[model samples]
Target: MTSSRLDGTSALVTGGGSGIGLACARRLAADGADVMICGRTAERLQAAAKELGCRYVVADVVDEDQVAAAVRATAATSPLRAVIHCAGGTTSVGPIPQLDTAAWRDTLELNATGTMLVLKHSARLMARTGGGAFVAISSIASSNTHRWFGAYGVSKAAVDHLVQLGADELGGAGIRVNGIRPGLVRTELVAGITDPGPVLDDYLACMPLDRVGEPEDIAEAARFLAGPESSWITGQVVNVDGGHHLRRGPDFRAVFEPMFGAEALGGVIPEE
Candidate 1:
């Protein structure tokens, strides 16, 4: 399990400053891949690169030029065989009737369009080297319904479909595109929602395993898909959730109601 399955190759890990992104970068580097981590924060990426002993790039995935530059930098020394896009989050949350248009667009730009630009530029470099693997860190919300998570769900759903199309289009170039839908993972991003409370309890109740996931859980899957072990797999969005998808997404009403007003969300979120 610790063998150098990706020796002599290179990997580009986005949002590598922390959480699942950093975990994947560590796993990939430990496996002997020349790794380059990128993110919007210079201070964090600097710290991560120093600790991980991998190169770092300060680039925004939503920016095409920045994304393209990151790819070029990663492949400059070795073939960029693996691109793990773990950079994405949503600021937009509310009922469809009250969804902020600007927030919605921004969420789509960051999650959905950002994914396209990353894949577009990374594929250009990967195709030149005869092909590579692209792993997208998606969410179960993309497939399952999570009421009050308007823009985020829509955007991630787009990402899932985009992966399918990318896999279909890039198969000829020897590239494989896949996605990972993670369940409720313990990370700083979701810290507020998971602070020992009713919201956290609801999430645990929905999960068949009745526990949260770790960054390494998703990282292990990324390592496999990026290597030859999943050589025949492509165009598939694998769920790494703790059986949460089998039931339903957590009720965010307990959390979102306090912000957007219970009456508003109640008007929309169906009661089961």
Candidate 2:
């Protein structure tokens, strides 16, 4: 059982339908916060909320109106004390030069812009309610130059800076903003892309902890940042990758090369 550090407070988690978002919601709820989760899918949101004993809101982070409405609805139910921005994903993966412009735009729009919008609206409510904490789900790829993770890494890098800027601007309002850069967590998003066997092995070999991260691992970091434990910590991106960041990331190009062929990878894949 988790401690009730957040009793009588409320938390809003974007992308809470599944994966890291759902984990964060459950952790906050367990800590005695009235949690509300928002996502684009109604069915997933309903199921997640039911399981977490929280509320659900169908809202896409990319949609400004929907995000504002979600915040307003959550605030009406309880004092908004925490906001976890976890709704982001890469639309495509490849080298920057060959990457489609549409994919690049979409990635930034979802990962970076989405975090900004959530932080913007959530901060406003937090300021009115005596302030709170804001946590954004970032990626260790933001710092490393991982092959085939160009757009995703770039977008997360943008999120890292946004968290810093938000922390600086909202400090006067008593609002603390931070980010969690998870390494390789086995979530549905990861499962949809490729088999985890080889990737997990690669990560475990380099990771000091000798294992891949779980959703609950990142959830614990989110819990710390959202709760009073991290009151003095702000504007920082915490790495929760089980020491994977100390070394390089998995070479995704090596995994996809045979399927896509060397010619298809263009300059993205280096000569062996």
Q: Which candidate number has the best TM-score?
A: 1
- The root-mean-square deviation over C-alpha atoms between each candidate and the true structure, in angstroms, is 2.9, 3.0
Cα lDDT tens digits for candidate 1, 179-213: 99999988999988768898889889988898889
TM-score of each: 0.96, 0.93
What is the RMSD, in Å, between candidate 1 and the native fold over all Cα?
2.9
Q: What TM-score does prediction 2 earn?
A: 0.93
Runs with alpha carbons beyond 4 Å of true place in candidate 2: 1-4, 192-196, 263-272
Candidate 2 lDDT over 1-272, as tens digits, reads 44548989889999999999999999999888999999999999999988988999999999999999999998887899999999999876765555678989999999999999999999999998899999999999898767777589999999999999999999999999999999888788787333646666776776898766789999999999999888889999999988888998776656667756676566644454
- Residue 51 of model 1 has an lDDT of 93
How does candidate 1 fare on TM-score? 0.96
- The whole-model C-alpha lDDT of candidate 1 against the native structure comes to 0.92
